[model samples]
Target: MVERRRFSRIIYQAPATIRQGGTVVEANIQDLSLHGLLLSTDGNNAELNCDILADIEFTLPSSDIVISLVANLIGIQKNIIHASIDHIDIESIAHIKRLVELNVGNDDLLHRELEHLSDLGEHLSDMGEQL
Candidate 1:
């Protein structure tokens, strides 16, 4: 497969719950990037173009993280759901970026990604403060 993604992706399996309004579905994330994730479910038929709210849980070297983000359903190939992050917090985004840095194994690329994290734009919310 050709790598057409702007940011590099890494295989990451994590437990996740995807919710759209009252409907909820469980899935395991197969691949991840700072921008989005590809998840797989048994027989979920999530609608395309709908906004999905997800809580993805994973463990890193030190701490366990639960990343809560809102994403739009971009595509679905059989059981795979390709969702793009539409909203997240700064801390969560930074942690995800750090995880990617750990997997990417390139010092210069990590440094550059650190710089790019600040430019992820206004989609990041202050919802953490409310919680």
Candidate 2:
């Protein structure tokens, strides 16, 4: 029963730094999507609605292009923070997308297709329960 609209989540562990104002805090990126990212940090100081800047360093699988993206933190839950890339950060995502398109095999497509099938099944199940 995943509540998120984006069901296709690729888990990746990478070092991240969240800079709020002048203070910088270290964290880890647990999951990623085109929309937002899940961050695991130590302290609970990352508030629900606090916006912070994140410097993420991660390597694309099988590629030597280790990229760092500066993103904006959008929300927090428990010790995990969620962030969405601002408009200016689209280029970075675009670069990643291109890399995935070039390198990824049929597995990525299969997973995305399975996610849609699961959503359909869930919708039908909900309708059955309602009836």
Candidate 3:
């Protein structure tokens, strides 16, 4: 398959909860990137283009990271629900980026991406140096 995303995606699964209004669904993150995340869930199909708030929590090999954000439901295939991040705070963004960098296991790629996000004023600490 041809890669078309504007941002690099890290294949990582973490437990999550999706909430829209008063409805809540348990889910798991199938993949994640700076712009979005794919959620796997068994709940009823969400309305297309609907916005939902979610809390994703997971422990890394070394640390735990939790992210809270509003996202737009973009697509659904089988059990996978794709959502584009509609809102995320800077601190959560940094933690999301760090989680990707750590799980991706690539120093050079993480370095370059950090430099790019940094240029855009969304800088996260480099895990490259620590590795």
Lowest-scoring 10 consecutive residues by lDDT in candidate 2? 96-105
Off by over 4 Å in 1: 46-64, 113-131
Tell me the tens digit of each residue's lDDT in model 2 across 3-75. Answer: 8554344666676666665666677878765545788888844433364465555665666756567667677
Using TM-score, rank the candidates from best to worst.
Answer: 1, 3, 2
Report model 2's TM-score to 2 decimal places.
Answer: 0.55
Q: Write the per-residue lDDT of candidate 1 for residues 12-120, one digit (tens) a residue.
A: 8876777776667788888888888999988775543344454444444345666777787787777888888877788888888877888999878767655564465
What's the distance in Å from true for residue 123, model 1? 11
List the candidates' TM-scores in order. Answer: 0.74, 0.55, 0.67
C-alpha root-mean-square deviation, candidate 2? 8.9
Q: What is the lDDT of candidate 3?
A: 0.70
Each candidate: how many clashes? Answer: 0, 0, 0
Q: Cα miss at 125, model 2 (Å)? A: 37
Preferred candidate (lDDT higher): 1 or 2: 1
